[model samples]
Target: MCNEGCLIADLELTFTVKGSHEGSQKILLDSDPSLRIIVFHCVINEQTRLDVTLPEELADGNETVKSGVLSFPLNSLPVQKEIIVEEEAGVVNKYNNRKIIANLSGDLDVRLGFNLCMEEQEFLRKRKKYVAAALKKILHLEEDLKEHEVPVVAITTTGGGTRSLTAMYGSLLGLQKLNLLDCISYIGGLSGTTWTMANLYEDANWSQKYLEDAIKEARKQVTKSKICCFSLDCLKYYYEDLKERTKEGHNTSFIDLWGLVIESMLHDKKDEHRLSDQRQTVDNGQNPLPIYVAINLKSGYSAQAFREWLEFTPYEVGLLKYGASIRAEHFGSEFFMGRLVKRLSETRICYMQGMWSSIFSIDVMYVWNLAADSEDFWCRWTRDRVTDIAEEPFLSMNPYEVDTCLFTPSSVLSSALRDVLTGRPTIAQYPNFIRGFQMHSKYLESEGFSTWKDTVIDSFPNKLMETADDELSLVDTGFFINTSYPPLLRSKREVDVILHLNYSGGSQTLPLDQIAKYISGQGIPFPKIEISEEDRENLKECYVFEDADSPQAPTVLFFPLVNDTFKKYKAPGVERTPEEMAEGKVDVSTILSPFTTREVCFSEENFDKLVKLTDYNVLNNEKLIIRALRLAVARRKQRKY
Candidate 1:
C-alpha cells in the first residue's frame, strides 16, 4: 500500500523459548512428541529473515545450553520467503500480495483545458440524437435530419428557497406537457432549484406523469413540523453522525445540521447517495444533464462579491472560471502538490446539496428560536449559549460574515462559544474546494495551469499563500448570482437556447440582469438582457431575448414566476400579510428562510395552486415558447450550413 520510495527500517523482537531435553543431550524440539517450535518470517528490501524459538524448558537447567544471537549479512539473506499452509487444519486458505507499479517518466501535462469529460461527450452524442428526434416531431418535419441540425438547449432554474423548488417542478411539468422537456440537452440549477433537481433525479423514471406524485410527496414533507429536527432521536442521530464525521477528518458544523433538516424535507432520512449515483438515471441519455452550482468563498470577500462558479455534474465537478476540472468521484479526496495524496469516500448527495443550497445557513437565529422553544433542556441551553455570544450580529448580517466571525474569535468565551456553535471543529478542519497546487512557489511557477495563468490568477489575490492550506471554502451560489449562468455558458456546451426559469420573489428582471452582468464581467457570451421600463412596470410571464449579430449566443427565454397574468393573487415572499395567510397561502415566516426570520411553508391547497400557477405560466405562454424554439432551430440550422 506504500507509494514509490517510501522507506521502512529497524526491527526488534522478543521471544520465549520452550522445549524438552533428551538424555545427556540438549535438543531443540520440533512440532512433534513433547516440544513445539514456531518460526517467524520478516520481509524487507526484497529479503527475508527467519528466527526459530525453541521451548525454554529444554535450556532451563542444562549446563550445555547457551543463548546466542545470530546475525545475517544483508546480501546473504534470501530474497524470497516461503509460506507453508496446512489444509487439514485450515490454517491459511489463500495468500497473495497486491502490487501496483506506475510509470512517471514523461513530462507531466498539467494544463487546464476546456473540454467535456468522456462521459459527457458520450452523453452529448446520444443526447443530440434524442434531441434531433424530438425536434423533428416538434417541428413536424417529414424528413430525418443530421445530428448537427439539432440545437443544444439548456434550461436553468433560479434559486428562491422552497418556492423555487415547487415552481421548478411545475414549470418542468409544463414543459413536459408541451413535449419540450425531451428537447432540452442540459438542466442547470442553483439553491432551491437544485433541491428539486436532486430529488427528481433520485427516481430514474421521473417524467411529467410522476411530477404530480413528486409534488404531493414534497408538500407532505415540507408541510410537516420542524419538531423532527429537534427531537431527541433525531438529535442523537445527528450528534453521533457528526462526531463520526469529525473523527474521520471531515469538517463538521451547524451547516451539517441544516443538511439533516434538508434531508428530512427531501429524502425523509439521511441519504447516502452521491451526485455520481444519478448517472444511472441519465446514462441512457433520456434525461437532460443535471448541473448543480455553487461558489467558492474568497478569504476577505463578502457574499455579494462576484466569484467563480463551481459546477457539479454526474461525471465531473470543477470550476469553469479557470478551466480546471476533476472527476466528480475525487471531489472530497485529498489532493496535495498537484497530485492526489489520498482518495477519501465520495461525499454524500445530502452534503453536496446542503453546500449548494446553503442559503439556510443565514437562518441561524430562527433555528435558535426553534431550539429555545424545544422541550429538551440540552437544546434550550445550547441555543441560549449561542445566542448570548452573537445573536444580534448574526441576525442582522449574512451567514458568510457569521462564518468568518466564528473562525476569528475575539475572546476566550467567544472562542468557546464558536466551538460549541460550530460543533467543536474549526472552519479549516472541514473539507473544502480542491486547490491546483499546495505550495505558493509551485503555483507561481505553473500559474495554476496555462489557461488560468494570465486571467483567473490575476483576478484573485494570493490568498493561498496567506493560508496554511491550499483549499477554499465554498458556499451557495445564490450568494453571488442566484441564477446559474456560468456553468451553462461553458464554451464546450455551445448551448443554442437557454430557458431561464425565474422563481425569485424579487422583481422578475433582477435575476436576468444579475446573470447578464455576471457573464459580461466574466467574458462569457450571452444575449444582453434589455428590459424596458415599461416591461419592468408590467412584467409578463415570459420574455425572449436574442443576439442577432452573435448567433452563437444562446437565445434567452426568461420565464419569471409571476401572478399578474396567471392569477389575481400576487406571489408572496418569505412573509405574508394577514389576508394572504387567511387565504391559506404559503407563509414560511418561521421555517428555513434565506436571510430573514420570515419563512414560508405552503399548505397543500396553496402548494397545489402555486404548482398550477407555475404550470400555467409556461403552458399559457405556448406561443412564446414555440417562437423561441423556432428561432433556436433556425439558428442551429443556419450554423450547420
Candidate 2:
C-alpha cells in the first residue's frame, strides 16, 4: 500500500451528543480520521444507535478500519430539559413560571383586558390586610370591621411639570402626617407627579420621616441652576452616558438627554438608578404599590385616539391595552415573538422619568428664555439696551404663542448644532423606542391578536396595526389622560375608591371627565362624572362622583388645586404682586402654567407656600377623604351580602 493510504492507521473518532429527546452517545472509528456520523430522530423513551461510517477517501484506503455502534438511553436525560419542553408547550406547572409564559404575558393579546400580574395579586393581598389594620386604628372602626369589608383604594396624582411635583410631595406628606398613607393600597402618578414618587421611593423608608427630609432636599435642588442643557460639564456627562447606551444597542434620542437633565435637577448628581431597583422600596410590603404611567405613540395620534397606557411597577412593566407584562428587570431587553431575543440590562429609572415628563418638545433655548422671561429676569437683562432690538421678540410670547417660532426647521438645525457642541440632544420627539414581536397575519388572526374584532383586520387604519412593523414608539401618558387611572382600574385590582388629584391647568373636571369618557369607551367601569354647570363654573377644592346604576364602579374623590378654597388672597389667573409673594402666598400663575422652567430658583417662602397650599388642600378636605373611604367600605359590604 502507498504511504498516503496508510497515513491515518492509528486515528480514532468519537462522537458525543446530549439532549432530553435524544441522549448522550459515543462512537468509535478505528484507523481512520476522516469519517461521517449520522443520527436520526429517535422515538420517545427509546434507545437510538449512532451510525458511524468512513468517508469516501477513507473507504478507498488500503488499510482496514474498525467500526463500533453507540446506543443512548433517552429516559435518563436531564429533568431540566423536560421542564423546558413543557414550558415550550405552553403548560406552566409552577406558579413561578406564570410570569414568563409568552401566550399569557405577550403584548399581542389585545382581547385580554387589564389584569394584575401574579406577583401584583399576591402583593395586593398583603397590602389589603395592612390597610384594613391601619384603617381600623385610624377610623376607630375596629368593631365595624367584622361586619364590613376593607376597600381597595387607589390615589392618583396629576401632571403639571415641576410645580405639580412639589405639590404632590406636600400632599403625600400631609397624608403621612394624618396616618392615612398606610391605608392607601396603590399610588399612581403621571408626569410631574411621578417625579415626587420617584424621589420618595429612592428610600425604602420613604413613608416615614425620610419623606420630609427628601422633600426639603428636593426643594433646594429644584431652586438651583435649571439649565443643565447649557452646562458644558453636565452636557459632557450626558454625552458619554448616552454614547455608552448607544453602544449597548439602544437607540439614543432627545429623551435620553432630557433624562440626564432631570437626573441633574432631581438628584443633583448622575443617575445610576435602575427601574428594577425600586423593588426594594415595596419589598416586605413596606410601601403602597407604585405605578408610573406612559403612553404608546403612533403617527398622528391624539388623546381621543385608541390610546394604550403602559404601566410601570416595581415588579413588571407592560401595556394595559394588551394585558401583557414582563418583569421590570427585562424592560429594555431585546424581545421578539413574545420572548427575549437578547438579554439586556434593565433601563435606568432616569430614562423612565424622562419619558413620564416628556410633554415638552420645543427647543431648549426657547424653554430657557421662556422661564427667564416669566420670572422677569429676561426683561431686566434688556432694560439698559437700545429700545429697537433690546427685547427678543420671542421673550414676550407664551408657550403656545411661540410654537410657530420655536418648532421650525431652522430651530431644529440650531438644536442639532447645540447638540453637536454640547453633546446632548435637548429636544425630544418621542419618549422611547419599543421592541416587539413580528407575527404573520394568519398567526395573529388565529391567536385573536388582530386590532379589529371582526375579519376586517386587513383594513385596519393605524399603520401600527399592520404586521409590517415589529416595534412601537411610546411617549408620555400626559398626552392621553394625563392623570394615571388605567393601572388602578384594572379588573383584577377591583379598586372601590380612587382619589383623583387634579393639578392640570385645564378645567377642574378635565382629568376626571377625560378618564370617565375613555374608560366608558373601553367598557371599563368607572363612576359617571356628572358635574353640574354650577360646579364647573365655580370649581371647589374637592368633589365626589358616584355611579348609582353600577355598584362595581369605583367612587371618585376629585380634588382640584384651586386658590379660592385655601389661599383666597392668591387669585386665579392673576399674577401675585411681589409684596403678596413675600407675604407667603404662592402665585398660582407661576405654578400652574405648562411652562417647564418657571421658578427655577424658588425662594424659601415660595417653596413653603407651594407645600402649604398643597397640604391645606388635602387637610381642608379630610371629611371628603374619610367619606370616600366609608362609601367604598359600604359598597364592599353591599357586594358581599
Q: Whole-model lDDT for model 1 versus the true structure?
A: 0.62
Off by over 4 Å in 2: 1-114, 144-148, 300-303, 361-363, 368-465, 568-584, 589-601
- The sequence of per-residue lDDT tens digits that candidate 1 reaches over residues 88-116 is 22111221121112122332122245777
| C-alpha RMSD by candidate, in order | 13.5, 13.5
Candidates in order, TM-scores: namely 0.72, 0.69
lDDT of 2: 0.61
- List the global CA lDDT of all models: 0.62, 0.61
RMSD (CA, angstroms), candidate 2: 13.5
Which is the leading candidate under TM-score? 1
